[model samples]
Target: MAPAQYLLAVRRLRADETTPVPTGAIAAELDRSPAAATEMADRLAERGLVEHEPYEGVVLTEEGDERADRLARTYEILCRFCRDVLCIDDYEAEASALVGTVSADVAERLAEVLLTDEKAPSP
Candidate 1:
């Protein structure tokens, strides 16, 4: 899946745990248009990330849960790196910029160091 789509899937799956999120909810949360949200939902459903319950709501499958967990962890590590080590004031922007470019090896190394160094100042 494309990175944006992957992030959308993760966000939708996360919403499911907290509330019965409709497609519109996803769109609003992501600041995407309704059509885009519908399209994203269709793609995610095709990939088994979610199941459509007709008029009910969407629910995340086990595969979606695993993927979202991994993505969330990666995002958290990037946020820590940008805010703690790099001393970036705009952590969200910096972290988003790094998410797609950072290699898994580098992310792991950063995660290791960040995990070990708990005293780093929070942004």
Candidate 2:
């Protein structure tokens, strides 16, 4: 949702400059326009989260990668919860519902609880 989703896409698709993720690819992933992806990329560049080359592609900066990794992990945890708790069969359903709704802090807390619960010895 919003710019943060784009950051996650960039990190998941291309975390390194050696293999940049194309705007077209990002657009496809986000179900947005190429222009939309490029614009978001530009915005992210301004924040020093990514390097966007018009023709080359976009790659996440170190900070961007770290942030994106956190977002991606949060999403995965949410997805797992959806499947295991809510019994949602479609991941997209979970994604579309949870995207933008959850905050980083909430996500991290949820992750800690879920992971801790998962690791608790089943007595």
Candidate 3:
């Protein structure tokens, strides 16, 4: 859930061209209730992953940004694998890939394998 929220926050940052994203935007991105999003933000703040100010917004700490980048890449790799290799539909692939239990090493290896295989011709 933290990963998911981080992704959402990253996306919002990219789209809005801002540092701290409004809590409302985060809530909208996650399709979560505002209270839930605020609660999550507070938890992330406690963990030193984000800096949150009531009625102001939240921004990821440097460590949080790094984690979010890795998580996003892992998610993309998993989604590609599910869609291309497993032949799952896009929607299902997106949802199913949220089971991001793999370590960073595993995710990097999987991503490399997927890229290499993509360049290989169909046999």
Candidate 4:
């Protein structure tokens, strides 16, 4: 799973990433097992993406926050593309499901198209 999921959960639980967010809460938010959440949290910490507290929870490291923010932006762009461009009914959900799966190149291309479309004069 993408580390951004954990970051998003923490942000959803509370905006501030400095505060500890319990692993159980994360598991519940992501609908995964506690062990899985812990495992991912540990992996994130190893990558300097997050700080996993043994019993308490995890905190988003500075790098984690930046990644999360970037992911958020990408998600929004994807949502707009799916909705306004592709006419998908469940754009937000589709975008949310694509958080980590979409390639950066694809995301950039989508963003470019979105920008271009927005700038284009209406037909």
Q: Could you tell me every candidate's TM-score relative to the true structure?
A: 0.71, 0.79, 0.77, 0.80
Candidate 3's TM-score: 0.77
Number of the top lDDT candidate = 4
Model 1 worst lDDT window (10 residues): 1-10
The candidate with the higher lDDT, 1 or 3, is 3
lDDT of 3 by residue, 1-120 (tens): 545545545554654434678777788876678888888888888988778889987877777766776666666666666777778777444633463476667766776777566642
Candidate 3 segments exceeding 4 Å error: 14-18, 91-100, 118-123
Q: What local lDDT score does residue 45 receive in model 1, on the 0 to 100 scale?
A: 82
Clashes of each: 0, 0, 0, 0
lDDT of 1 at 54: 46
| Native-to-model Cα distance after best TM-score fit, residue 3 in candidate 1, in Å | 5.2
Residue 68 in model 3: lDDT: 73
lDDT of 4: 0.77
Candidate 2 error regions (>4 Å): 15-17, 96-100, 112-117, 120-123
lDDT of 2 at 1: 45
lDDT of each: 0.63, 0.75, 0.66, 0.77
Candidate 1, residues 1-123: lDDT per residue as tens digits?
244444534464454464444766666766677667667767778888876554444566678766655555566688888887779999976666566566556777786676566642221
